[model samples]
Target: MPAEEHPMIGVLLNGRTLRGIRRGSTQHEALQLYEHAAARLGCRICYFRLRDISLRRRQVKAIIPDGPVGRYVTRMIPIPSVIHNRAIHLTRRAQARLGRLHHLRYYIYNRHTRYSKWFIHQLLSKHPDIVPHLPETRQATPTAIHQMMERYDTLIIKPSNGSIGRGIMKLFKDGGRWHLQYRTAGMERTLRTRRGKRSKRRIRTRRWAVISFRSKLPAALKRLIRQRRFLVQQHIPLACYMERPFDLRVSVQKGDSGSWQVTGIVGKAAPAKLFLTNVAQGGTVYTLEHLLAANPSLHPERVRAEVERLALLIADHLDRHLPNLADLGLDIGITQLGFPMFIECNCRDLRYSFLEGGLWEEWAAVYYQPISYGQRIWLDRQVTSGTAN
Candidate 1:
């Protein structure tokens, strides 16, 4: 902890990611992104978890990324003025702890990252400009589902806090019958006689299936909806590439000047047989330019402009309600006629999709943007308090 060192920006990860950093084996989040960003942005990175904070001492045992990759130094330093939250805090206790930190005058941007899908929809519904871009959404009650089915041929049922396309159900009615498409994770099997059996063996899983109902909504589906909070939305027909439906993942963030900007956009196409276009669920990523080139009918310039406009509008509107919503990954769909439709909003964006799409510069910019934004917050806090950052 040298005073001569550059100002530090804290990165708060979950316990598992913190341990992986100690072992130098974390794969999901590329630690090198921060290393390179530090060199370019002139701000060091301080990696810590909630448990690492010591309020009584007013300091934290933060990991400083120094030397080569997979190398760092641990020091008991005063908590950085700015923090970027990378962890999902779902429990009541976890949230209260974050609140405690906030009360201590810490600039924790994107601290409350996990907003429910239904909550976001409700907020955006009030904005006239953003309403047409949003699909029709309702709580997943049996009565609501029946009412929606009467109006729209297809609907989407998804968990309020789901991610990566998990816990999503697609429902469509055809020929006076209702069909549902969903996926199940690999099923588990138990072997009582472990001495003579393979206890780890599992049934073939991670496959998609469809169930049909003739006259009424299935009882099991109703029970599932009641067991957990779900939201139903009218399914928007998405533009297709290679005969498969696709959507865009737009990366929006506040830059050095604290203004929202669209940093990158990548195309996510559903698998040949699957309906969800999440990369975790057998989806493929393509550059927007490449996708537009393959589909000759889409006007690239118009589509790009509209997408940026909608993304910024959504970001600005959400920031008014959500505190410090500086970074977001929005899932927006495009119709055959080239209109941007809202799908979902992710507070803490995983920028890997840009890397997968082969947009190297955009991918790097995604990492560097946060550093620049954090620096802005740090500078502003100092000016407001008449002290150093």
Candidate 2:
């Protein structure tokens, strides 16, 4: 083994340049937290973009016992002690490349598996505590959608594989009519223009609806190689702040004691005229206390308890089923009755939410330093045996 590849304390973040990407605010927050944690732990951390780092499938397989099949099992990687997988948009080649490096003990805030998407849904479906918070939901299809439309006055169709609230649509029904509303590609405003006053004239300008026909989104997305399918969920008619919907983001990281902890909590309020509370759509984050206080109907303590419980539950569930996840950023929402619903569990790009004071201190103790040093011993033994043969 190379000297730099020694069993030293450090973290490897897997992704691209943080600035160029959309929805970078959350990414920047996470990167900063990881860097701070790495420093406090007396460890070095490096960032690698899976898209940039070239890898040959055959080469990665050569190091493992069952070859390519070992990826499904716990194997070792050629380099590094810990890997923080932050690759939000994974390419087919990148997925294959990372799968083979199982020996290095790559850590994810969420599980990266073929059924990872479905696993999230399963958690929501099984957990009675969180299920009541969710709106009426079902798998998406052409035939099943009409029933959803009938049940709910408004609905949302979202791409299962997407992130940062991209390719999400919000639908509304008025007078037995349906219209789609959404934010445009860029934050553009629609203003009525008139050179001079005309006698009772009407003008129509093209505007992107939050809810759009699947045909208008992109066919190129279908061409991208994927491990699984998409989902159609019931849109939660969120309690609004000035007529726009909002949601809460609770960031959770694994503590060094092999437990889950909530690092930060932020309530994301959507921009004016937008239904989604995604930060990419100019949403704002507020302190949990202030947010709950603003809405007197919600019980802040209960919501916090539920958030903490669900975070641990998801972390435990992922660790039980996948065993490789280190962190999870759960998107949760509150209904009028102060019920907490499960929006989604994002394992891919687990962003940090440090709304409270000294949030980094808590994060440093857990994520800054790795959880298990014992895994390294077994990895070394395997490498030694391979060399001996």
TM of each candidate vs. truth: 0.95, 0.68
150-244 per-residue lDDT for model 2 (tens digits): 67777776666666777666666766566666445554344454765443544444346433343233333233213335455677756566555
The numbered model that scores best in lDDT is 1
Q: The CA-based lDDT of model 2 is what?
A: 0.54
All candidates: CA RMSD (Å): 2.1, 10.3
Which ranges of candidate 1 are over 4 A from the true structure? 1-5, 190-204, 386-389
Give the alpha carbon lDDT tens digit for every residue of 151-190 in model 1: 9999999998899999999999889899988776566666
- What lDDT is reached at residue 241 by model 1? 89
Task: Report model 2's TM-score to 2 decimal places.
Answer: 0.68
**Error of model 1, residue 345, in angstroms:** 0.2
Deviation in angstroms for 69 in model 1? 2.7
CA lDDT of each prediction against the hidden true structure: 0.88, 0.54
- Candidate 1: global Cα-lDDT? 0.88
